[model samples]
Target: MTPFLTGLGASLGLIVAIGAQNAFVLRQGIKREGVLPVVLVCLASDAILIFAGVAGIGALIQSAPALLVVIRWVGAAFLVTYAAFAAKRALRPGILEAATAPRGMTAWTAVLTAAGITWLNPHVYLDTLVLLGSLANAQGSPGKWLFGIGAATGSALWFPLIGFGARGLRGFFARPASWRILDGCVAVLMLGLAVVLAAEA
Candidate 1:
């Protein structure tokens, strides 16, 4: 039970931060477009990663610094591209009203984007595979599995909350200015993350 609680607290602490993934999910939630699929993809991805970590894959990953380097470059490029798109949207903000709102992403596109955002980030690997893996293993035996379950549970709870919970903000986002501010913040965050990734050792 202690291991479970520790896992839950650690998982939430890492994921609750405002990142590209969270921003994307929030946007999809508010727009009421492909929310379920997006949320499921993120949740499933996190669960897989968490379990894989507990399964001892983290040691293999640690041995391959080159793999992380490749991922870092790719992730940085992806983030920069996303940041540019966000900046473009910020330049021409639109209201969230159905009639005037821009065309939303299809379920397939949203799912793919969600997967990319979840899988491409080097930070995700570090957090789930390396850090959480170490933490879970330190708990030993059955406690490790329990910790993994608890971590996965945190992801399960969080994605739905942000994805479905964002609907409440639809009213506020109906204002173009609000959308502009949101997009602007997303752009900055994405760019900042890209810079950090590129500069990281």
Candidate 2:
């Protein structure tokens, strides 16, 4: 129970931050587009990574610096491109009538984008594969598996909360200006993250 609680708390601490993946999910939630698929992808990805970490793959990943280097560059490029799209949306805020607004992204596009955001970020690898893995391993054997389950549970709880709970903000987001502001913030965040990733590379 202690290991489980510890793992839950640690996972929340790491994932609660306003990173690229969270921002994307938030936007989808507000737009009410592909929310289920996007949330599921995020939760599933986190579970896979957390368990993989616990399964000792984290050490293998740590030994392969070249893999991370490639991921860093590719992730940076993807972020920049995403940022540009967000900036474009910000500049061209369309009429956002709750019942009439066009869907900004298809389900397939949202799923792919969510996957890219989750899988590409080297920071995610460090946090999940390295940091979480190391923490889980410290618990030893069965406890480590419990710890991994707890961490994955954290993701399960969070993604749905943020994704579905965001629908409550639909009234506020009905305003085009509100969308503009949200998109602008997302753009800045993506660009800033891209710059950080590039710097790290």
Candidate 3:
């Protein structure tokens, strides 16, 4: 039980950070584009990564800096591309209103984009695979599994809250100004992440 609480706290502490993943999720939720599948992919991927970390795959991943380097370049490219789209949208705020906007982004596209954001980022490995894995193992044998479960539970809870909860702001999002603001923030965030990744790479 103690380990469970620790896992929940630790996982939430990490997961709640503002990042490309969370930003993408919020945008999807606001757009009403494949929200369920997007949320599912995010949570499921987190579950897999967290379990892999707990199962000791973290060591294997850590041993390969080359692999992380490859991921860094790919992730930076993806972020830069997405940031361009966000910036364009911010410039042309007319398409911001989903109710009047043309159909866009298929379910597969949303899922793939969400997956790319989750899997391509090297930081996901550092946080979920390495850091969370270390914390789970620190709980010793019995508590480790419990801790992993608790951490997975945290992801399951948090993604939904952020994903669905953003819908409550749909009224505000209906305003073009709101969309511009959101897209501008997303652009800055994505570009910033891309620059950071490229620098590290």
Candidate 4:
């Protein structure tokens, strides 16, 4: 109970951020396009990253400064490119309607998209392996475990919430205005992330 409670709080703190990957997940979820694969890939990736943080091995991800530098630049590049794509989508909101379902949706595409968004973004390592791991270690022993559990729980809980929650709102979101709003929100988030990446580099 202690570990779970502690984990819940920490996880919520981190998971609340609406990043590019998350935006994609929510978008796909709203469209009900290949939900299973997207959720699986996201949860599996989260489990791996969170478990790495919990085991303390995530601490070693930055052992090589050169490697870290390379990852940072690569991450920044990806974020910028991805952000451009997101911006384009936002500008042309009808694309989301075209992406509707069946015709262009596939399980493998969702997996690849989620995986690319998760693994390709060095921000995942920076946040999960480095930042989250460091924070957990700071707690020491039981507290460390508590924080890790909370972080992991956040991932586990969030994927389903984002997936299904979107479904529940499908009726309201069917509006083009809602699509514009969602795309605008996603665009803003991706652009902000892109700026952060540039600053980090």
Best by lDDT: 2
How many backbone clashes can be found in candidate 3?
0
Give all candidates' CA lDDT scores.
Answer: 0.89, 0.91, 0.90, 0.75
Candidate scoring better on lDDT of 2 and 3 = 2
Model 3, residue 11: C-alpha shift (Å): 0.7
**Model 2 residue 151 distance off true place after TM-score fit, in angstroms:** 0.2
TM-scores of all candidate predictions against the true structure: 0.95, 0.96, 0.95, 0.83
| Candidate numbers, best TM-score first, in rank order | 2, 3, 1, 4
Per-residue C-alpha lDDT of model 1 across residues 1-201, encoded as one tens digit per residue: 988989899999999999999999999998888999999999899999998898888889999999999999999999999888778887853422332255657889989989989899989988999999999999999999999999999999999999999999999988777877888899899999999989984
lDDT of 1 at 197: 89
Q: Which is the better candidate, 1 or 2, if ranked by lDDT?
A: 2
Tens digits of lDDT, candidate 2, 89-173: 7775343343226666799999999999999999999999999999999999899999998999999999999999999999998
Residue pairs in candidate 1 whose N, alpha carbon or C atoms collide under 3 angstroms: none
Candidate 2 regions exceeding 4 Å error are 93-100
User: 1 or 4, which is superior by TM-score?
Assistant: 1
Model 4 RMSD to the real structure?
2.6
- Model 1, C-alpha of 168: deviation from truth (Å): 1.0
Choose 2 or 4, whichever is better by lDDT: 2
